[model samples]
Target: MTSLFQFTGSELEAIKLSVGVAIYSSLISLPIALLLGYWLARKQFPGKAIIESLIHLPLVMPPVTTGYILLLVLGTRGFIGQWLYSTFGIKLAFTFEAAIIASVVVSFPLIVRSIRTAIEMVDPGLEDASRILGVGRLKTFFQITVPLAAPGIISGTILAFARSLGEFGATITFAGNIAGETQTLPLAVFAYMQVPGREIETLRLVVISVLISFVAMALSELYIRKMKRS
Candidate 1:
């Protein structure tokens, strides 16, 4: 039983790849999410509705469909992909990079929505006051709006990270779950479940996934509470 419980080299590699993909995806998504969220919260433009709809599209779209779209747009034979590969030797499909992109796409909406809500929570009067005090708009935003929204940003970032950690459908569809490459824990769990004698391994991975999610949520809650107190 102990021997069976032991993770093989491939399993270890899968775990590492999973963490790498999730971390990369979350970090890359954070700044973009912040900027878009701020824009959505603070600005009202003619095509704002269209942009907001696009940002929220992933929340409603099927993960598999999103993955397929990514493949179509970023595959080796894709127009953009062909240019990337030819000009810069970059290709995205069926690779860890693809997995990161899939994770980012799926997780982005949560971060954006969270931060947008936070931004809206900030009082516009504060900005008015700052402007009257001769503070530039950008300075007011960096000092007042952003700090006030810190808790929301933190919660949103954690949510995105957690979403990335658990992403499966988009990742597998776009990256093909190749071991030691694109296979994250969710993909590994699926693969293990399909094997003849890996139920325990699958269960273990499931437990780990649950634990990771639980921790992320707990941290978010803690931050939220602290923010409220502050």
Candidate 2:
């Protein structure tokens, strides 16, 4: 089992990259998800249904399909991708950024859903009282709404981080599993599975991924419980 304790360079890199991507993806998606969730919870605008459906499409679609759509939009030769490349020399596909983007797309709907539910559950009268006291909407949001929705926000962020850590199909499809760059735990596990005598490495990565996901979920649940009790 000493061999199992010994981590290969690739394994360590994969762990680090996976964590970095998960963190970046969670941080990047939070503000947008917060605003979008508040909108979905509070607004009754025309075409909102269509917008929400589009936002949630990734959740229902096969991850590969989502990745393919991102590819079409962001690839070097793709539709708008060509314009981006011609204008800015920016090619997003098969890159570290692409992996984070993939994780964000796939995990966004879940975060939004959680936040929206939390916002909806909050009493509107509280917001109205804040408004009557001359608090601006933005201030009220940060001071009142956000504190009340802290449980959901924290849970949603944890869920996003966990989902990003375990992301595979979209990441692989868009980022191509390049080691020490776009490769994460799931990708590393996949790679190790393909190599002979790599069983230990694969097992270790799998255990790590599962443990991380479980801990994230547990933390979310515990925090929710504690908040409710208080």
Candidate 3:
């Protein structure tokens, strides 16, 4: 096995890109996840089931199918894609941006589910008490509710990050496997596997992927336990 520090330039680039994409995707999904989670936990609305099912479609559907849907909606000739390109000269397909978007879409359901469970675990009585004490609804959410749900939120973020890191099919289908541009760690592993005698390189990337995901889950659990104790 190659030393962890002995990654080739391509491997290093893939690692860096994977981290960057995961971070961006997780951060970008956070606020939206928070809102959706809170709403789902506390509100009753029309089409609620539909909204939830749609949000979770990627989880149930094949990843490649999800990628194909994304391509049809965001490709260069797509409705939104055409407008975006024509107006802002931005092309989302087959780019780093697309990879991030794919990650966000695939990982969003997990994030929402985690945060919603956390929010539901919080006592409604506490929020009502705060409101009765003249705290605005928004303020109550930010102060009492969010802090109480912090563990869940943190875990959800970590889960989303890990999911993003390991994303493969959607990323490859939508972003293509362009090294140093859109190819992330998972993509690198897939690429290495296609070539003979690249077993060491492939194994190295696989180990790195496993290590990253394991570390993320471990940290999340550790922090959650600490939070609970506190």
Candidate 4:
């Protein structure tokens, strides 16, 4: 019974790395997503369409292409990468950090879109009333706007986490799929698939992946329903 569910060392490593990367990716991207979502929803500025198009480019672009671009810009010897390594001796390429970055890039658009829609649905009258009552913009945003849009933010965060857990092409490309380091669950599944007699392991990972995604979706749906009810 316990043996049936026991994970091998490599499988355990993959699961841990996947969860770690996904969590960090989601947490790191949340603030940026919130800012972008609010700006896109409530503010008007020049080149807004251009900014939106760029933000969503990852959704349309090949995952490998995005990975390649990251490698060029953030690789060990690349521009910012070189500077960081020289100044602080920090290397990003082929590391867990790179995997987190990849997940953030690919999942960012979805997070931003969800949050933007949620913010847009917030009542302008509430914000106006807050302002009329001498509440500052920042206070109103944190107090009223954020509370009202919490459902959407939570949904987007879960979706991003699910997406990060399933990330493959970008992670493999930028982070090199190193076992016990950058190799996440999706990469582990791909590795198992390439070898003979590893079908069981591959299938196990597939099941795990599907379950995680299903749970995330279910939670998102529940949030949407709750939002509707409120």
Give me the candidate number with maximum lDDT.
Answer: 3
Task: Point out the higher-scoring one by lDDT: 1 or 2.
Answer: 2
Over the stretch 61-168, how does candidate 4's per-residue lDDT look in tens digits? 999999999999999878999999999999999998999999999999989999999999999899999999999999999999999999989999998999999998
Candidate 3 Cα deviation (angstroms), residue 141: 0.6
Could you give me the TM-score of model 3 versus the true structure?
0.97
Lowest summed lDDT across 10 adjacent residues in model 4 is found at 1-10
Candidate 3's residue-wise lDDT over 95-162, tens digit each? 99999999999999999999999999999999999999999999999999999999999999999999
**C-alpha lDDT (0 to 100) for residue 27 of candidate 4:** 97
Tens digit of per-residue lDDT, candidate 2, span 105-169: 99999899999999998998999999999999999999999999989999999988998898898
- Cα deviation at 121, candidate 1, in Å, is 0.7
lDDT of each: 0.89, 0.92, 0.95, 0.92
Worst 10-residue stretch by lDDT in candidate 1? 1-10
The whole-model C-alpha lDDT of candidate 3 against the native structure comes to: 0.95
Query: Model 1, stretches more than 4 Å misplaced?
Result: 1-5
Root-mean-square deviation per candidate: 1.5, 1.1, 1.1, 1.5
Per-residue accuracy of model 1 over 1-230 as CA lDDT, tens digit each? 57555877887887788778878988998889888898899888899999889998998999999999888888888888888999999989998889999999999999999999999999999999999999998999899999999999999899898889989889988899898899999999999888898788887777778877898799889988988898
TM-scores for every predicted model? 0.95, 0.96, 0.97, 0.95
For each candidate, how many residue pairs have backbone atoms clashing (under 3 Å)? 0, 0, 0, 0
Per-residue error for 187 in candidate 4, Å, reads 0.3
